[model samples]
Target: MIDTERQDWARGWSKLKGFVEREGHARVPYEHKEGAFPLGQWVAEQRRAYGAGQMNGRRAARLEKLGMAWSAADARFQENLAAARVYYQEHWTLCAPRSAGALDKPVGQWLSNLRRPGALDGHPEWEAALEAIDEDWNPSWPAEWQRHYAVVREILAEESILAYVEPGVTVHGMDIGKWLARQRQSEVWAALADGQRERLEAVGVVPHVQALEEPAGAEEPAEPSTAPVSAFDRGVAAPGAVQGPARAL
Candidate 1:
């Protein structure tokens, strides 16, 4: 009786294994069909659609059901998009125009080419040079400026000098020149380290202010408009405006 029960169990297990094998084979053709669903390809398509602002609620839901989380994918797409923008801003000048009246080739293509395997196969030193260029490039000047500005304010505070102008006189503005003059006149300036003075100069808060006074017999220069000049308007190169590694290409 025991032998018969053991044989019955073996037969059942064998049948189950055969069923699973047959089902797997049957699913192969559908899964591997010319235009069937492959996870990587499907995810890529969804990402492209999302990046182009075409992924609607229904499509997003469908993708979620296929094990692709929309949030994670969208975040990655946004990050790549921002990086692409920076790459373009930094390297636009490096790209030669493809034709007359034509814009330079998109930076995306250059990035793709650079990222490909064997991209520097014949010239390994190019890779090292590019890395060095990247190390030297800074793309976060706004933050740097903010920190420097804070330090300048702190130094002024220690001297009890207001760095900003009277509210109605200049519409809540910073008088960089006045602040610099005060610093120069105060003992704090002499006590500051050389690096601190250098930092102040680097931020363009020097004691030198271009005289707006009109020359003798010349009309008073239109009263010198009160409108403020942004850093960009003053010809300051913004973050991502630095030369990039692509210049070597």
Candidate 2:
């Protein structure tokens, strides 16, 4: 009976070592099997034993050497966080919708779920890890809106004249010109939050508020009228020389 138990443990450890070498982590899926060996089940049993305080110190230390993660959920979070980091490096933003993915992970949907109210409760470390990649991994405004802002910022970094960016123009697959047109609308400009407006202004994207000429003998200032002015007519000077119309309060 003692010899049989030692052989069983040796077989399971061999299979687990091979699994770790191939996958680079000891996070085998629950139903995974290595040929005829139930490696996944064996790994789960060890975790159960560890939880029950029945696992031996030497055995647990050996498992840890192979990068074993006792808490499966913590292992999953680390994997997803790695994917998020990869996505951020490529796109410079984490405002991906449900359809986005990274490193074979459903990172977009994961981030979307995490952005829900109180979703990170008791998970401050997870929040910190994400913020380290991009501070606005979650924003007060819509994530999609933040995505647009990030892409446009990239375009501006190239010294592109955004005002002249016509409709249908795209940056990073986003229709920034169409988006800018919407932001220039009086109603849309009025609807934007103060912080959003300020960010736009800092980037020389203030709305083109052309003022109508004062009537004959009028004492009051010219009434401001917003128009779909051509880019040339929008006072789109080179960066430091940008002079935009006064925005409505």
Number of the top-ranking candidate, with TM-score as the measure: 2
**Candidate 1 local distance difference test against the native:** 0.40
> RMSD to native for every prediction?
21.8, 10.5
**Candidate 1 Cα RMSD (Å):** 21.8
Model 2 regions more than 4 Å off: 1-56, 59-69, 217-249
lDDT of 1 by residue, 94-169 (tens): 1212221212335344444555567657655444434443431222232223333453444444533332321121
lDDT for residue 136 in candidate 1, whole number 0-100? 19
Clash counts for the predictions, in order = 0, 0
CA-lDDT, candidates in order: 0.40, 0.76
Clashing pairs in 1: none
Q: TM-score, each model?
A: 0.20, 0.62
How good is model 1 by TM-score?
0.20
For model 2, how does the per-residue alpha-carbon lDDT over 99-193 read when each residue is reduced to its tens digit? 88987999999999999999889878778878888888888888888888887667666754565465666766787777877887889999998
Candidate 2, after superposition: displacement of residue 185 in Å? 2.1
